[model samples]
Target: MGKVYIVGAGPGDPDLITVKGLKCIEKADVILYDRLVNKELLSYAKSEADLIYCGKLPNYHTMKQETINTFLIKYAKKGKVVTRLKGGDPFVFGRGGEEAEALAKQSIPFEIIPGISAGIAAPAYAGIPVTHRDASASFAIVTGHRKEDAEEEVKWENLAKGVDTLAVYMGVSNLPYICEQLIKYGKEKSTPAAIIERGTTSMQRTVTGTLGTIVEVAKKEQIQNPSMIVIGEVVRFREKIHWFEKQAENAYPVSGVL
Candidate 1:
């Protein structure tokens, strides 16, 4: 039986993929990659490798999760090295755990290669640190998406009063609801907030505002998904140390999306 490697492709930039992850792609006989994964990295794969697209969009899934699991099993059982490449750290809201569980049930041999998650990488690219020595001592990564009409399970109370910083992913759609929950749970309306769009890439755009006004700001800027929402005092540091935006100005200048 062949082995399966579930690798994180990193957030946006192709160069950020870990060495081991790259090696997996180079050696794999079959590769199943996701939508957010940077296609540029595929150039490293063997020319004979079979590339399969498993891209998923919000409210739409190009390939079902079950289908992906079946493909991994089928490829590995055929004695072919299989690689399942995801956009961010496999376990970090990338559904890597689910895939791992599927493999375990089938007794497939596999290794998980971790990649930099967008939650942290996006903020850093936008010149916002998720954690700061003085302003923030704690951090949390949260999902902005939720089931329609489902009961909310997020602990907004603690998130508002306890956590020093919050990195919210895929939350552009529910920005207003998120802000409302935070404030309803005791977070100050004037608390700093920012969203980094297409972060870590040449097309990166960052917009900042307070919890009270971010909704309007986002509407005006037309920010969309694949963005990171950062909330906390650490966001204030952007004004003084925002480096990526400067780099883009001098060298990278907002080029078209990759």
Candidate 2:
């Protein structure tokens, strides 16, 4: 049976890809890549290898979980080297855990290649650290949507009180609702918030405002899905610590979405 490699492509930057992941793709017989992986990164794949799109959009899934699991197992039975490439870190909110479990069920040999997670990368691009001395000591990364419980059941109240830094994935569409709940549940409405769109890419955008006004700012700016919402005092440091400014100076205004 074939060995499977779950690799991370990093955020949107091709250069952000790790040497290990890149080497794997270059020798892969088949590559199953995520939707957010930069298309240019695929050029490293073997010319004769097959490329399959298993990308998922926010609030939507392109392939059923069971189908993907079954497909991986079925392909491995053929003794080919299969690579499942994912965007950002494979284990961080990427469902790579489920994929690993599937591989174990069949006793298939697999390796996990780690990459930078968008959660950490996005905030860094916006000049906000997830942890800070006065700003925050702890942080939590969570999805805005969950099927098993009411939105309230996801424990926004406790998180609102417990975490100094909150990074919500799949949160753009639910921003207003989530923000309102946080404020209502005891988080400071005046707390600084920022959205980092297409982080680590030249087209990346950093928008900052207060929690009380971020939803309005987002609406005014038309920031859409696949974006991250950061809430904490650290966001206030953005203006002073903006290092991506150097990169921004060199970044041309690329035409197209970020």
Winner by lDDT: 1
lDDT of 2 by residue, 1-258 (tens): 899999998988799899999998998898888888999989999899999998898768898778888878888899889989999999988889999999998999999999988888888877889999887899998787745567564598888888899998888888888898889888888999999888878777878898899999999999976788899888988988878856677665566775
Looking at candidate 1, what is the lDDT of residue 106? 95
Lowest-sum lDDT 10-residue window in model 2? 145-154
User: Poorest 10 consecutive residues of model 1 by lDDT?
Assistant: 146-155
Candidate 1, 1-258: lDDT as tens digits: 999999999999898999999999999999999999999999999999999999999879999999999999999999999999999899999999999999999999999999999999988988788998999999999888865553573577678888989999889998998999899988899999999999898889999999999999999999988899999999998998888778879884565876
Off by over 4 Å in 2: 146-151, 250-258
Model 1 misplacement above 4 A: 147-154, 252-258
